[model samples]
Target: MKVTLERTDLLKSLTHVHRVVERRNTIPILSNVLLRCDGGQLALKATDLDLEISEQIPAHVEQPGATTVPAHMIYDIVRKLPEGAQVSLETSGDNATLELRAGRSRFALQMLPEADFPDITAGEFSHAFTLTGRDLRLIIDSTQFAISTEETRYYLNGIYMHTVTTDAGERFRGVATDGHRLARAEVPAPAGASGMPGIIVPRKTVGEMQKLLEDPDAEAQVEISEAKIRITTGNVVLTSKLIDGTFPDYGRVIPQNNDKTMLVDRDDFKAAVDRVSTISSERGRAVKLAISEGRMVLTVINPDSGSATEELAVDYESDPLEIGFNSRYLLEITGQLRGDTASFSFADAGAPTLIQDQGAEDTLYVLMPMRV
Candidate 1:
């Protein structure tokens, strides 16, 4: 293949596709990116067997052909090229290597036969839908952090995605839980999503989707089946094998009647928790929250480190309650809240606590309390 493309265009596409190539690959071809130039467009693809990403960028194609080269190596070479310089890639008549040229720099990389690249996007999809990048991001960002890392309970490792009918209307929802905490967020369901089978998007795919769908206004096409998912954003297409497992009935874990409500300035509460948790031990990272009529005191006591405390005024009229939670989890949840006010609903210190942005009912978080 002989193609010349702007450094910026090639570098951007490489950044997205190369990330799918893992550094350590049991199969040599898996570490290389497949490059195909034809019809005035240059396409780049990379995969780690389980996940694959492909992107196309405009290029001046003197010849139309395809070859595979190290994904990271080509990405780095193009990334370091002088800004606005043209990058040319060509394979010799023998097709054993690919030559990359950018201004005064040049490198020859070994090429693998394009026939060796695997194709995983073949099967039929049960459903297909479209969502704006904004909605797509909101679904993952709100819950991704809570995805469980425990490999044994494999079902909890990815964002659980499905459609639900609420009293108000049908909504598309994403839920993730690591046993200790759970996050659920939803957007109004789009066309072609009703009755679609719930799918557990693997952790890596969810993260890649988040990164690929960076433009708020861009539209993303989603196609899914019980075994895989494909997301197309702009010129980029990402496909991944789904985790074949059943997600637990998370609804049972969501608190139903936590009536005691507390309103606190989100910034104030976050700042207080950050200050008090400074002295918290790494192993036990627990921060105690003592909530009373209109005051909340945050405290952390570590045997190895000194205790720290911070107080903030809140809007709670219920009886006093003290609860402990992982300080890191608290900060992460608070940072995701979009409103100035964070509403907390408590049912004593032993039960799961529900938190949400005061006026935004589309998202909610549940945190299990720890004994202080």
Candidate 2:
């Protein structure tokens, strides 16, 4: 196989495909990327058993063939090569050595047989839809932070995706929780997704898809089967195995009777929480929120350190209530709000508090209170 590619184009493809290769692998072939050259394009693929990414880039093909090489090694070599250098790769028939040349530098790298690479297979998708990159980014960023990191509850380690009917129309909802906090976001459901089964997209897949959606104007084609999910955009394709677990009924956890309400500037609330958290205990980071008629105060206390309190004018007319929460949790949820004001509803000091961005109807958060 002999091919020539510009440094910039080759690096872009390598960076995208290399994300699928794990730094360490139990199988040698799994650590390498499969490169196939034919008809003026080079196909690069890498997989880590659970997720696979493939991309094709334009290249000058002198001789068409296929081979496997160390993914990270090749990426590093190409990344460090002189800018605008023309890269040339050549390997003789049945040979395990790959010759790489660029500028005044040359290197011979070992290659693995292309036949050794594992095939990632998926069944026929029951649902396929298209979402603008912006909509997909909102759904992912709003919920991914709340996904559970606990290994035992494997079911909660991913975002739950399904179609739901709202007053306006049908929409796709994404929900995630770690038992303490929950985040839910919705976007207009793409056509043909009506009867699709709810699926839990694993944590790693969420990250890879987020990276692939960096172009806000690009559209992504999503295909969902019972056990697999695939996302394709531009010249790239990513396939991942869905987590094999049932997500809990998240609707039940969202409170409906919480009537007491407080509206405050989102940035002000976030800043106050950040300031008071300086004195919060390291283990729990608990901060107390005291709300009353037109006033809200945030305070944190630590036995070894001291205490901090900050007051802010708010729009609240409910009975005076005091609630405690983890400072980090409050800050994270508040930071996600897109509007200037954050509206919070409460049942009491002991029940879960519902938080929503005042002008955004597509997202909401629920946080269980902690005893101060």
Q: Write the per-residue lDDT of candidate 2 for residues 1-372, one digit (tens) a residue.
A: 999999999999999999889999899999999999999999999999999999999999999999999999999999999999999999997667999999899988899999999878557888999998999999999999999999999999999999999997999989999999999999999997898999999999999899999999999999999999989999999999999999998899899999998999999999999999998778979999999999999988898988899999999998999999999999999989999999999999999999999867899999999998
Question: Which ranges of candidate 2 are over 4 A from the true structure?
Answer: none
RMSD of each: 0.9, 1.0
- Write down the TM-score for model 1: 0.99
Query: Please, what's the RMSD in Å of model 1?
Result: 0.9
| Backbone clash count, each prediction separately | 0, 0
Lowest lDDT 10-residue stretch of candidate 2: 117-126
Model 1: worst 10 consecutive residues (lDDT sum): 88-97
Error of 2 at 159 (Å): 0.6
TM-score of each predicted structure versus truth: 0.99, 0.98
Q: Distance (Å) between predicted and true CA of 105, model 1?
A: 1.7
